[model samples]
Target chain A: MGKQVPVAEGVFTWPSDEPRLIGSKCTDCGNVMFPTQSGCPKCSGQTTETVELGRTGTLWTWTVQGYPPKSPPYAGDASPKTFEPFGVGYVELPGEVKVETRLTVSDPEHIEIGMEMELTFVPLYTNDDGDEVVTFAFAPTAS
Target chain B: MTTDDVAIVGIGMHPFGRHEGVSGMDMGVSAVRTACADAGVEWSDIQFAFGGSAAAGNPDTMVSKLGLTGLQFINVVNGCATGGSALFSAYNSIKSGMFDLGIAIGFDKHERGAFRVNTRSSGLGDWYGESGMALTTQFFGMKINRYMHEYGISNDSLARVSEKAFRNGSKNENAWRRKPLSMDEVKESAMLSYPLTQYMFCSPGEGGVALILARADQAHKYTDTPVYLKSAVVRSRRFGSFEVMAPSVALEHNAGPTVDASAAAFEMAGIGPEDIDVAQLQDTESGAEIMHMAENGFCEHGEQEHMLAMGETEIGGRLPVNTDGGCLANGEPIGASGLRQVYENVLQLRGDAGERQVPNNPKTAYTHVYGAPGISGVTILAK
Candidate 1:
C-alpha cells in the first residue's frame, strides 16, 4: 500500500471510512467553528469541545473557478493546456456553520444552490516523495 | 456640532495605469508636490504626514525626497482600506487639535494580474492556503452569485455596471481603462469566474494619490475651495457577515462592514443617501458595485437592476456614481484605491471634473471602500 497524507492534518478525521470535518462547539455560547478553535470567537468562551461536523450539507452558493489561480500556495496543476477548472462554494451544514469548500463538479450547469452534497476525500496532487496528497471536497450525495 | 470638522485643502493623483519605468516612490513624490502646489503651501509648511501603502515601502521615505522636515510621519497598512484609514487618522489628528495641517498619501505599483495575498500575513492558517480557496476573485464570484440568486439580479445587470464604468472612464483622462465597453461586449468577454467576465473585474495597477487636510478654521488659508470632510469612518465585519478570505461563516447574518461604515458616516455628516449628489464606490468587480449600492443605503435590495436600467447611476443620472470612473476603470492599487475615490469626489465637489462632471453643481459626495475579510471605510465630503 502507498503512503497517504492529508492536505492538512487535524482538519478532518483520517484513516476511517466515515471521516468528518473537525469543528469546535463553544460550551458557553453554542457557537461552532470549522477546523476547531482554541476559544470561541463570539463570547471569548474558553470551554469548547471538538466535534465532528455533519457529513452532508446544502450548497449555499457556488461558482466555477474557470481560470488557474496564481501559484505558491496553490498546488493544483495550472498549465492552461492541462489545467482543469473546478467548482468552489460555501456549503451550509445544518445548524452548524457555512463552510467555504471545493466541489467535485467543475461544470456550473451541473450544480444548483440548495443541492444536497456529501463530503469525500480527493487527491489534490502528489508530492515528489510519492505520497498521495488528499483534500476534502463535496459531491452530489448518492440518492 | 462642528467640533470634529476637518477639510481637504488640496488633492492630487498620478494617472491610473501602467507606468513602465516609474517607481511608486517617484509617483508618490509627484502627487505630494502637486498637492502642495495646489494648496499653495510649501512642503516645509506641512506639520505632519500619514501615509498608507501595501506593496510600497516606508512612507517616511517621502521626508528624504520632499525635504528633511522634523515632522511626525506614520505609515499604515489595512489592506484595500489603507487609504481611507490613513485619511481617518489625519482627520482625527486635526479634529483632536494635535496638528492643523497634515497630508495623507497612498501609493502603490503592483504587478499586473490578480493580486496575490500573503495568507500568513492576513492571519489565515496553513490549511486555508492549502485548500486552494484563497483566491479573492473566487470569493467575490461566490458571494455575488448567491446575492444574484437571492435578489433575482440578471447577468445583464453585472454587464451594465461594467458598461457604465468604461463609459464614464472614457471621459476621465486619469482612468486606466478609458475605452467604453458596451453591454454586449462585456457579456461576450472571456469568462474568468462563472458569471464574471474579464471586463467585469478590475486589474491591480499602479498609482498614487495625496490629500492635504486641515482644521476647518485654518483650511481657508490653503485653498479657497477647501472641501470639508464631514466624516471618515472605518468598520470591520460583525459576526455572520460574509466576506473575502474567511474559510467559514456564522449561521447568523449581521449587517456587513459597509453598512455600518456608511451609516456612521451619514450620521456624522447629518445627511441621508438622498443628499449625496455625486459619489464614488468600490468597484473591484461589477458585482461589488451592484451590491455596494444597496449596502451603502443608496438604494434598497433588488433595486440595482431597476436603478441601472433607468440610468440612475450614470454621470448625469439622479445619483451619479463613479463620476470620474471607479476602481473598474482606475485599476485597484490596493492601498491607493480608497483615496482615489476621494480624489474624484474632491474634483466633483470643486466643479473641476471636466467632461465627466455631473449636471447639477454637486454639493455632497460619498465614498466607500471595502477590503478583505469584511473591512469597510466610508467618507463624506461637501463643497
Candidate 2:
C-alpha cells in the first residue's frame, strides 16, 4: 500500500475525523459556493469568507458515466482494459448549495434521486511517486 | 414594429460531413461564392461581413480570397452560437442604417473523437477535468434524467426524436447522416451515457454556411422572393440554470437561456409561437430536441411525451421540426450549425426543398441554437 494524499489542496480539511468539504459564503447576500470562488455570483459581493460544507446531503440528480472519459483533460490513468463505469451526481447540502461530485455507485439499479448521501474520500489514482491520490465523493447513507 | 424589415436575399452551404482534403476556410470561401452566385452579386458588392469558427483559422484573414475591396469584416466567436452572432451582427448593421447589404458566414473543421477542452481557458480549475467529470455527454444524460423524472418523460420519446431526425435527413441531399434509423435501433445503440444512445448524439464535423442580408426596401432589386428576417436575439444563462462545466448549482430553479431568447424573438417579430409554420432547433442530441421543444415555448413541459407520441412534430404533422435534419444529421460544424438552420428554413419557405418541403407553404420559420456555458440565440423569418 502506498501513502495516501489528497488529489488537490484547499478542497477539504485534512487530518480530521470529521472531514468536511470547504466552501465559501457571501457576507453580502448569503450565497454559498463550493471550492471557494473569489466573488459572489448572486450579489457580486467582493467580500466573502470560507466555510466548511455539510457532511451529508440528498442526491438531486445523477447519471452513469457508462464509458471511460477522454484523456488529456481526464487524468484518471484509466485504460480500456482496466476502466470501470462510475456514477456522477449533484448532492444538495440543504439551503446552501448543490455540489457536483462523483457518486460511490455506478449501477442504475442501486442509486436513486433524493437518497441520503454523505461525503467521503476515495482513491482516484496513484501518482508516479507511489502516493495514492484521493478525491471527494458522496455515498448512499448506510442507515 | 420593424417586422420583416431585414431580408435574406440568398443562402448557401458546403455539405456537412467528413471532407478529407477540404480546409475549413476553403469551404467558407465556397459557401460565400455560392451565395454571391445565388444572389447575382459580385464579391466586391458586399459592403461588410461577419464570420466565425471554433477550430478553423480566423475569418478576417480571408481577405485574399474574398477580394481586397476594403470591406469591414468582423469575426465572431460565441462558441456554438457563432453563426447566430454573425447573423445578429449583420442584421443589426442593415437595421442600423449604416450598410444596405452584408453577409454572415460560418465554417469549422473539428478533429475526430470527443473534444478535449482546456480547463484554464474555460475558467475552470484543474480538478474539474482531472477528476473525470468534464464529459459533455455526461451533463446531457443527467439533465434528461432529471427531466424524465420531473415531467414523466419516457426514454422511448427520446429515441423517437432521433428516429425522426434520420428520417428527415434521408429526404435531404446535403445532410451527413442520410440513412434513416428505427426507434428500436436508436434504443439498442451503444449507451455512452445513461438515457442517451450513440445514434442519438450529433458528431462534430466540417461544413460552411453563408446568408446574404439586405434591407427589405432594397431586397426586391436583388431577389423578388426574399425571405425576411423578422427578428433575431441572443441571450446568456441566468443563475440556477444547469449549464456545462459547473461545479455547483443554486438551489433556486430558473428556466434556461433558450426561454428568454425565444420569448424576445417572438416579441420583436410581433408574433407568437402559434404563428410559426416550421422550426429548426438545435438538436445536439435526441433529448435536446425534446427539451428545447418546451423551452422554446412550442409546447408545455411534460406534454412532450404525448406530443412526441402523437407525431405532431413530424414533417407532415401539425409542427414540422428540423425538416432538414438539424444538427443530428448535418453534423455540428460549431460555427456553421446556427446558419444551417436559417439555410434550411429559407429553402422551405421558397419551396426549394425537394423531398423534405413542408406542405401548405410554410410562410414563417423559427430557428434556435444553444451552446456551452449556457448561451442561446433565436431567429424568426417570414416570407
Candidate 3:
C-alpha cells in the first residue's frame, strides 16, 4: 500500500464545491445507499452509480463511544487520556439514504433523530509523518 | 388484532452443509423444486416470488438464482433475518389478493467464516471487523457474557439445551450438524465465547429453504392440514443502543426487538403464551434462547433456567421449544434459519416431526427469529 496520505484517495468525492457524501441510486426501486455500492439490495438486478447526496441532513440517532473500538480502519490511538468521547450518529439525507458518521457535538444527550444537521470537515488525527488526517462529520445546523 | 389470513401449504429444505459444487442458485432450485413437489403444485402455478440471500457471490450478476423470472416482488438481504424478511414480503403480497400462491425462497452457500454488509453501497455504518468483531459468533459472545453477569444462568442448563438439540438433529436428515452431543461433551467443548462453549455458538452452514404460501382455500389442495400464518411481525431498531434502555422487560426499558416484535405478533395472532404449544426460538447463543423465552412470554423474566430445569420446554412439557434442536443443533445457515424454524414448527404441528415431535401435537406455534446486530422477526402459525 502507498504511504497513508492526508486524505485517502479513491475514498470518493463530490464534483461540486458543496460538501456531500457519495451513494448509489437504484434505478429499479429508486432507493439510495451511502458510501457507494455496486448493486441494490431491494431489486438485486440493476447496478448502482456514484451519486452525490445533500450536504445537510437530519440526525436519525446518536451515541457516545464508551470505549475505543478494537479494529483498524480508524487512525487514532486508544490512549484513554488522549482519546476524547467521540459521538456517532445516523444522518438522514433527502431520499431514504441514512449515513452513519461521527458527530461534531460535545454532549450526546442533545442529539435526537429528526434533528437538522450539516456536513463539516474535521481533522481526524495526525499521521506518522505529521500529516494532518481529516475526515467528514455532521454538526447541528443553526435554525 | 386479527390480520389477513395466510397459510403455508408447502415447506422444503436442502440439507445444510459445505458443498463445493452447488452455487446459491442451484441450492435455491433444489429447495424450490422440493417445496413444489411437497405441495403438489407446479412452478408456473405460483403467482409471486420473494428471494432472501446474504453473501451471494457475484450477487448482482446472478439475479435468476431465486427463479424470479416473471414473478414480481421484493428481494431482501437483511443479514441474519433475510429469510424472515422474505417471508414477510411474500405474506403481504398474498394478503393483497394479487396472487393465490406466493413462493418465499432463501439460499446461502457461505464458507465457514464471518458475515459483513458492504457499507460502501449501503453506507449505514462503518464496516465491522472481518474475523474478529463482525462475526456473529463474537457479537453473541459479548451478549452471552453480559447475560451471564445479569441472569446467573448455569452452564449445565445451556449444555442441556445443546445436548437435546444435537440428539434431535441426529435424527434430522436435513440438519447440518446431526451428530449426537452429550451435556458433558458440550460442557467440555472449546471456548468460542466466554461463558459460551463452541457447542453453544451456532456454526455457519450452507443451506436453502423454501416455503409456499397460498390462500386458505387453495392450501387444502396441497396439504391435508395446513399451517396457517396467523401473523408475521418484524421489529426494527429505530435508533442505536445509546437511546435504548438498560436490559429489562419493563415497557420503559428496551427489551430489544425480540420482545417488541413478539408482542406485536401475539396481538395480531390474538393468542397468548397459554395458547402456544410449541416454539422454535433463535438460540444463536444460549442466552438468546433463554432470554427470548421470557421476552416471548413463554415464562416470567429471569425464570428461564428454572423452567428449563423443570422440563417445561422439553418435548412433553408445557411449551415444547425447538423440538428440532434450534440453531444449537441444526447449524446456523444464516440466511436460511428463519424459514428453517418455520419448517420445524409446521412439522411439529402437522405431527410429522418423527422422534422430536411433541406429544400433544400443537395447534398454535411461534417462531422468534433474531439477528446479531439487533433485529427481530416473529411468526405465529396455527394448525
lDDT of 2: 0.90
lDDT (Cα atoms) of all candidates against the true structure: 0.89, 0.90, 0.70
Full candidate order by DockQ, most accurate first: 2, 1, 3
Look at candidate 1 and give me any clashing residue pairs.
Answer: none
Worst 10 residues of 1 chain B by lDDT: B122-131
Residues A7-125, candidate 2: write the lDDT tens digits: 77888887578798889999999999988888988888998899999999999999888777878778786687888988999999998999999998999999998999999977788
Of candidate 2 chain B, the 10-residue stretch with the lowest lDDT total is B1-10
Interface RMSD of 3: 10.6
Docking verdict class for candidate 2: high
Measured against the native two-chain assembly using Cα atoms, what DockQ does each of the candidate structures obtain, in the order listed?
A: 0.77, 0.81, 0.04
Clashing pairs in 3: A36-B120, A37-B121
Candidate 2 regions with alpha-carbon error over 4 angstroms: B1-4
- Tell me the TM-score of model 3: 0.70
Q: List, residue by residue over B282-357, the lDDT tens digit for candidate 2.
A: 8888889999999999999999899889999999988999999888898999999999999999999998998888
True contacts kept of each: 0.73, 0.78, 0.00
Question: Candidate 2: fnat, from 0 to 1?
Answer: 0.78
